[model samples]
Target: MKPSHAIQGKTSEIKLLIESYGFVSPAIFGSTASGTDLDGSDLDILAIIPAGMRGKISLFDIQHLEAELEALTGVVVDFNVENSMPDHLRPPIEREKVML
Candidate 1:
């Protein structure tokens, strides 16, 4: 399959996978969401975990999850912790992120 935007068909599958791994509110952003993705661009994923479940989802765990997503989507996946992102990134992320 070719690279795609943050449409429901693509996002829904990723959303299910993310939730299964205990991540909450999964979303996609950057060029994919902005409708300018190139063949080489990676998928930008922004997500957070429930406060109560944070301990179970460590950085390593998220990295593994990101690998899974990359494999499934056939695109490099860049997973980001929503709360940890820089303040300056919030606006662009808000403007670009598509809810999954």
Candidate 2:
């Protein structure tokens, strides 16, 4: 099923936020992918920011992101920030993500 308008709006906000941080990989995971469900679901965002931006993101920034997402999409949004991850861990997590 296609994602609801709320989910799509949140995704767009997240994209803009990621862009503001200079992330260009286009490898973002979660609801943007096919088969995602919108109702009663949260967003999962994973991106690799520049070295200088690492460890600089604070809890307040995350809270702000969440708030912005809620304001724009009217659904709860969650963010996970990481510098990198093991290759083997990516697929399983992405595959098992609960979008519905």
TM-score of each: 0.88, 0.61
Global lDDT of model 2: 0.57
Q: What is candidate 1's TM-score against the reference?
A: 0.88
lDDT of 1 by residue, 23-65 (tens): 7899888888888888778888898878878678888888899
* Candidate with maximal lDDT: 1
Compute the lDDT for candidate 1.
0.81
Q: Over the stretch 2-23, how does candidate 2's per-residue lDDT look in tens digits?
A: 3355655355555676556554
C-alpha lDDT (0 to 100) for residue 30 of candidate 2: 63
lDDT of each: 0.81, 0.57
Segments of candidate 2 deviating more than 4 angstroms: 1-4, 9-13, 21-28, 31-34, 84-89, 94-100
After superposition, candidate 1 runs with Cα above 4 Å error: 5-8
